[model samples]
Target: MANGWAPDGAVQDQIDDTVKDAVLRARGMMPSGDGSDECDDCGEDIPAARRAALPGTRRCVACQAKRDATLRSVGINRRGSKDSQLR
Candidate 1:
């Protein structure tokens, strides 16, 4: 039931790849170990609440927010479609 030239399961494969990519991206964004008591970026004390909530956090709230903003600004599209590449 694939459209055009795609073979059967092609669409499903694409969907699976997209989902895998998203999962990997999310995992990469998460901290790995116990969160530090101090911000890695600014040397400020990382709040206990934040450390408790995000176990691997390395930055203070403000630094984390800034880093998030910066990351958001650099948009990543995992679709890898020809149309997307053209743009």
Candidate 2:
């Protein structure tokens, strides 16, 4: 059945677009490998272990946590199908 403003498939398309936008935005947020030891947000020292684990890490653990918490995630298909969304 079609909704007033959106067709049946149109809602799915909007969802897909939203997912794609979220993925692109997340990719853009990936920390770059600038080799900076200081946290970009807090200016704290980036631990050696963290640096080793995340080669391209630019934020310290605390800063990274803050960023992660602040990060916004959109509804994306986990199973590549709408069945998952129905569950």
Candidate 3:
């Protein structure tokens, strides 16, 4: 069932797109290091515990937190194209 004047599958497609976008965003946010226990951003020694908790972590926890905050502010785009129109 469509809501308002939207098509039947529009809402579902939006949901799927939102999920995909989130997955992509998460992948991009992932650390891309070789578990060196070195902070890629500041070149400081990363703690062993931190390395274990977040494998492949490139940035320090503080830097990563700051980056995450910036990402949250941008929000996500939900435009629907024909490719997205298929649901």
TM-score of each: 0.72, 0.58, 0.63
- Judged by TM-score relative to the true structure, which candidate is superior, 1 or 3? 1
- Total clashing residue pairs per candidate? 1, 0, 0
Worst 10 residues of 2 by lDDT: 72-81
Top candidate on TM-score is 1
Error of 3 at 61 (Å): 1.3
Report, for every candidate in turn, its global Cα lDDT versus the true structure: 0.81, 0.75, 0.76
Better of 1 and 2 by TM-score: 1
Pairs with steric clashes in candidate 3: none
Q: Tell me how far the alpha carbon of residue 78 in candidate 2 is from the true structure, in angstroms, after superposition.
A: 20
lDDT, model 3: 0.76
Q: Give a tens-digit lDDT track for model 1, residues 1-87.
A: 987787888878878877787788888888987668889999999888888888988999899888888875334455567987999
Of the candidates shown, which would achieve the greatest lDDT relative to the real structure?
Answer: 1
- In model 1, which range of ten residues has the least summed lDDT? 72-81
lDDT of 2 at 78: 39
> lDDT tens digits, residues 1-87, model 2?
566765588767777888788889878877665667887788888889888877788888777788788866646553356777567
